[model samples]
Target: MKDDCPWFLGYSGGKDSSALLKLVIIALSELTSYHKEITVIYCDTGVENPVITDYVYQTFENLKSECLKLCLPIKYKIAVPKLDDRFFVKVIGRGYPTPTNIFRWCTDKMRINPVKQIIDVHPKATVLLGIRNGESKQRDRTISKHSKSEYYLSQSGSKRNQIFSPIINHSIKDIWSTLKFNNFPKSIDSQKLGELYKDAGSECPVYRELPGKSCGSSRFGCWTCTVVRKDKSISKMIENGYSQLTYLHEFRNWIAEFRDNTEYRCAQRRNGQIGLGPITLEGRKVILDKLLDVELKSGIALLQKEELIRIKELWQSDLKNPNYIEKTAHSRVVKVKTHPKPPI
Candidate 1:
């Protein structure tokens, strides 16, 4: 008998991943003669909307029920990053500049790291990611390389990591059509989620420092992303009567303002000498005061408590360093009530 390799299906509560999960479930059911373990893993950043989290949990329950019905041995796991206030950690906690395309340190820390940790344990496994061709040019290049390469680089095949993206060939329309025809798993409210997407009408911001400016008109990301000049996600949420989201929206808006004020950034790099251009002295003071005010008024710790401790320790160290000096706070920038123009 041939050895059965384990399957690690990546679940991201998105439509593509959900569809991929359904297909995998169906395929595994038909292949009942084989004795293989399938583990569905969802890497949580602890920042997803409550609705998304609920959907993830409910989907697992439904999948488990299906597995039992089919008498299959399919297990599931959900992993979340340390409650490290990722956004709050660097910006408010350590006073790092808001993320930009050039400095997208958040994705790896919050999105990729937790999943990579799981993969490390399953050194020899076939990992399935729901990356579709229509997603982006980067994804296209990745898939093309995987198709042509001797080993799948994404799965780290050199370490016996096998990546299988069955839906890479499917189009967005095809995916939705399949879901619509098959009916959304009872776990998720297709109608409500569809409404949310329609209303949100924002793309996930891959770039943070200047979201719309650099990445385009997308906001499906951290509520506190300072990259976009204006946060459409917050605006859409508020418009949809999610009043609680307003605080997050306001906070993000404030953060964007801080990014424009360059002074808060380091004159010299994290090391001693200047790497990039210097952030003006005034900009630095503006960013620090604003960040401190946001912490005080919002009464929300930007990073996880432990991360905050680390950030504060770093701040203290920077204060004492001869190369870097802490400056006094400056006057705050008053937010204009009028809605600003969206990214062109």
Candidate 2:
């Protein structure tokens, strides 16, 4: 309350973030005078689990109405990646392989950078997160390494912006209690969240800093995530009655396998180096066809119209000069390790 600088709250529609938001709203309500404006930011990766995405959109609507009703100084924003950076545009248009642990490239483009762009406008803004200490051993290590105090952490590469985690010390049990018991706003439905948790697990962080977990590790993450060998959260959701996810689940599995298939990849890298290159033009066509089929079967708009236009533009440009570098002319060559083929 003392600092009057603008505050940006990162909300991932997860239990921890939900609990933290509840506390923030309650705190703001009790304040006699507002010192600063608070903006709740959510990064929609475009490929988020449909079930969780619906819930989050509805919750945002509810929060907007309720905050106005209570006369709280709060705003909401949904951040999204650029057209060229969207999942399908990269994978299908550019023939980029689906992300893997070693070559994981999706998180920054789809998640963090979108949110970071917002924060960058406010140089002195404080970013409030819902990170807790014991969520995982790696998380715990990260917290300890960057902690400035009980509630503050160092925002790497930024000396001006401050990072504050209100629930840094909150336990898993504490988070549940806060969500289940808090009655204000009435938008965060603890029961609904519980059901999601029962089927899907935790959520990926909306705005991760240095040393953070990649996307697809949570229920609220991208449905097209292939970083993990299998997306257990979506699988569980399908088994637990989310039959609509069947096609998406199958496509994710298929694409993960297809990404490693040598037949579908170019012989030269985009940088002109000799290595496992991007998906071949033929491979990209196959992917787009299959993705469209999945969209029709699942009744989900996986690719936006603008994204498709962008993809076509990219494809046309690539056709003009298919090779990034002429393999014979390049002096430096790197041998790419072949990956084991997925089960046929």
Candidate 3:
């Protein structure tokens, strides 16, 4: 309240973020005066797990109304990746392979970059996160490295902005207790959240300034995540009665397998080198066809109309200038003469 800089709160609609949001709202309500503006931001990656996505959208609507009733100075914003950077646009549109641990490119483009774009505009802004000390060993180490004090930490890759984690020291038990007991907003349904977590596990971070585990490890992550060998989270959810996820789970498994088949990939790299490259145009079409089938079966809009338009445009461009080059393993490099140095 004493600070004049704006605050951005990262909310992932998971337990930790829910608890942090509840605490922040209660604290704000008790205060008689407001010194700075606070924007609660949620990154909607479009490929988020359907079950959690629905919960988050509903919660957002409810939170808005509830905040208005209490007359709290809170703003809500849903940040999304640019059209070109979206999952389907890159894969089906550009023939990029599904992310693997070695070539994982999804998180930065889809999740972190969108949020960072918002925060970078306000260099002095303070970000509020739901990070806790005991979440994981890697997470604990990150916290220790970046710790400025008990409650504050230095924002990664920034000199001015700072990270303020109110629930930095909260235990798993304490997190649930906070959500259950601090019922000020009423939008955060602890019971529903608990049920969601019954089959699910940890959540993906909305902002990835501090690296630890990848998003594919979480049930609340993208449905198309293929970094993990087995998407146990969605599989368990299906067993626990989320039958709608069956088609998505199947598609995810199929794509991971499809990505490994040599017949579908180019023999040359996109940069004109001799190596296994992106999926071929025919392979991309096959994947798209399967995805459309999944969308029909599951009654979910996996790809937007605009995304379809963009995909077609990219296909036309790729037809004109192919993404791969016809290079052989024994191809020799052409040496070029270097320019003469400028006289001193």
User: How many collisions per candidate?
Assistant: 15, 0, 0
Query: Which 10 residues in a row give candidate 1 its minimum summed lDDT?
Result: 335-344
Tens-place lDDT per residue, model 2, 1-344, is 77889989999898888998999999999988998999999999899899999999999999999999989999999999998889999998898999998988888898888998998788889888888877668878877777775445656445667788878888889999999888876999999999898755556776665444554768978999998888888888888899999999999999999998877776678887778888765677789899999999999888899998998888667655635532222333323222122111
lDDT of 1: 0.56
**What's the C-alpha lDDT at position 229 in model 2?**
82
Each model's C-alpha lDDT? 0.56, 0.82, 0.82
Local lDDT at 250 for model 1? 74
Worst 10 residues of 3 by lDDT: 335-344
